[model samples]
Target: MSKVKIAVIGCGSIAQHRHLPEYAMNEHVEIVAVCDIVEERVNKVASEYGVIAYTNYEELLADPEIEAVSVCTPNYLHAPISIAALEAGKHVLCEKPMATSSEEAMNMIEAAKKSNKKLMIGHNQRFVASHQKARKLIEDGELGKIYSFRTAFGHGGPEGWSVDGKESWFFKKNEAFIGAMGDLGVHKTDLLRFLLGEEFVEVGAFIETSAKENADVDDTAVCILRTESGIIGTLAASWSYVSKEDNSTVIYGEKAILRLEEDPVHNLILQYKNGEVVKCELGGIQTNEEGGQTTSHVISHFVQSIISDTIPPVPGEEGMKSLQVILAALESKETSKIITIN
Candidate 1:
């Protein structure tokens, strides 16, 4: 049982926080290399992990020992880095907002298909215990004919979380390519689709930069989404929750209303039409309150999928579909019309 040798491209916040630590913790993985345009950061991470340091991603991807890579770079670079990794015969675990565009996402997918390598996207919300259980209950007919869902992911902006605070790449349109929609919204979009087992077919959005002084990117956004089965909902993503975050979802059904990631103690609460209530304690998601201490199952899942020769739960295609919803919402915002997913 040889370990999967993996490298992480981009030694930024996410790489330092999730990919580097999680891969180091995985028994089936060996963090063999790390790359970042910033030499100091790359050297720091590689030296800490006792691995090779590469200032260029191309150089890092050249290693024959590296079986996979985690692309934790900015939004604009996800597609190119992922495509190069796949072409170099390496599996890729690209960060959320798989690409800046659906077309770019599709290119990444094509590269994976041609390479026959696993291309997982870092949409780890699907691994949340409460969300997973809710999906199961819905599928098991406990919820009964889900009508709508309202999901939101917001915080006090990326200033507190990003490595560079307010001046981070997150607020730069050229670097980020998007703001909260791609950062936080895509996570919810993917999670909602995963939970309800449906695709968003239409979108209407109101995106704005109402907060975050000097930041050109949208600090807040609200999108109206309709799924393939006519299930409609509002998806909100914002960095303007100055006090606390509201990373919660409520699903309405004919028989019950399921609340996810809302309650402090329960984590999930369900109230039936007959007045019966059930509270379930579930695993927490990585959030500002926790300073992201909770474990994300993404690394383990990627390793296990490779070991088992199976597809990842959040494959590139799945990520692309979810990303498309966000893309549509962006178009809707710009055009002032309901955009249909093609």
Candidate 2:
């Protein structure tokens, strides 16, 4: 098979760290171009990869040889750029919080259907080694009759990770829509859905902008989520972990309790009711901290799905389902009532 000619639509930190590098590592991928509103960033990335650079995404999409693209732009641009790329006969791998609203997400899905192209969202949490193993164990009845869980993803802030630092689009409501919840919370929601293999039916949340100054969006959020099977859990996303990052989940079940990313050496641990403790040294998850840049496996999976003409692991419909939970959480925060998913 010929290499899949690809382009990255935004030369942001995610594009620089994850998408661009991962795509280059894939033997079946050929990066044809890069696009970003910032000419310097785009040019630097294109030069590093020996590819063409364009400041306009529409112009980049006009190239007939580009087979796919990774949309690493701000949250507000995910749906529109992904929809346009799909309509232009190209596969799309858009970043998380796929859209600002459920309607936009649905529109992107419809566009993909109309174009008959694969649309994968960049929900990398589902691709983590520990997460995948946890899902498999639950599926194999290792943790029989799951009861509750507490999952959190928090860090110092995006100021350290994003290209623009403190002034990044992440703090701007017009660009990011929601702050920590959209940036980090959605990943936990998607992962919980994947691990439990059920949909979240209700949400009650408290979202606040208590941490970061000069930021109009929330910096911390805590949500109560109930799955369709009546399994309830707490999900927390924050940008105020000053000293270290916390990306961990603990699940309780009738047979045993499962812990993911909780211990430094052991990525997964299970303690049974009969005094048996099992520790698995699965690989660490990717994080913003030093020495945490492990392979995400998202780019490779997206590339393989396109090459094999198969559905991606996290398709647009799946992304929309996970996104709806966040949307419901927002509504719950506003109305001070438990919001039910339709």
Candidate 3:
């Protein structure tokens, strides 16, 4: 097991831009195969990497040569494909919004445990340099008792990013389950939990499909969240930012405020109550725009975990917890009430 052989299950935007490239860069990983329903896309990627192409993920999983796989397919297929891969005795690195529901998420976790395989979720926001720094500062008491926060992730929509453009599964409710909330909101929920070291206890949201016409799924959502420690905040996800991407988080504390990815020059900024400001030029966060292909560190981390036989940084259980917040937000939108997380 010197070089863990791995395959990517979906040859879409995520696999192309993140998983495949990162895995290829990691010395401890060997790209064995790439799977996608689209024959041309899979073959092109396979040819580019000189690896095998698989139109059926089950066939890829049965190869036995592949020790791990990245599930980058549609939202609806995440659970089933991951569960199958785990059952087939392959470690899994699933993308964010792990599943459409808590039951499916728990099932995936159960499969990983039953098969004694690794199941890491791809919530790369926590791996951002600024985000990691913010977590450290909070942990070291730099931001004395956090009070409130506001985080947002907005872009020009997946039509520009997904390989299928406007016809991508992202705009389909059955395929994607939820829209902006599932695509972008879950990332914030996971990141908030990592930075604050707490779970969200309640959520109330207004999820709507106002921006993209002819789409049944939501394109914009605003959620109010309360942590277990009583810290309240707002989380927003939108696909209507026509001008530029806005991936920023502002955490207000008793003594200072921490802003992440909010500046063009500095990725992190700290403002103290004493009228002092500190700007940090930590590397840029990955964006959908050109030249925004910053390394996400997810694939590298996953490979390291598999090689070391250690639990992945963003394990299935952590993914499920993060996903619960989005599920609660969806419920809140439907009920028009604040939903409490169990």
User: Which lDDT values do the candidates have, in the order given?
Assistant: 0.91, 0.95, 0.94
Report the C-alpha lDDT of model 2 over 89-163, residue by residue, as the tens digit: 999999999999999999999999999999999999998888999999999999899999999999989999999
Per-residue alpha-carbon lDDT of model 3 for 1-342, expressed as tens digits? Answer: 478999999999999998998998898889999999999999999999999999998899889889999999999999999999999999999998999999999999999999999999999999999999999999999999999999999998999999999999999999999999999999999999999999999999999988999689999999999999999999999999889899999999999999999999899999999999999998899887888856999988898898888999999999999999999999999999999999
Q: State TM-scores per candidate.
A: 0.98, 0.99, 0.99
The pairs that clash in candidate 3 are none
Q: Which should have the higher TM-score, number 1 or number 3? A: 3
Instruction: Tell me how far the alpha carbon of residue 201 in candidate 2 is from the true structure, in angstroms, after superposition.
Output: 0.4
**Candidate 1 residue lDDT tens string, 50-88:** 999999999888889899999999999999999999999
- Residues forming the 10-long window of minimal summed lDDT in candidate 1: 285-294
Off by over 4 Å in 2: none
Relative to the true structure, candidate 1 reaches a TM of 0.98
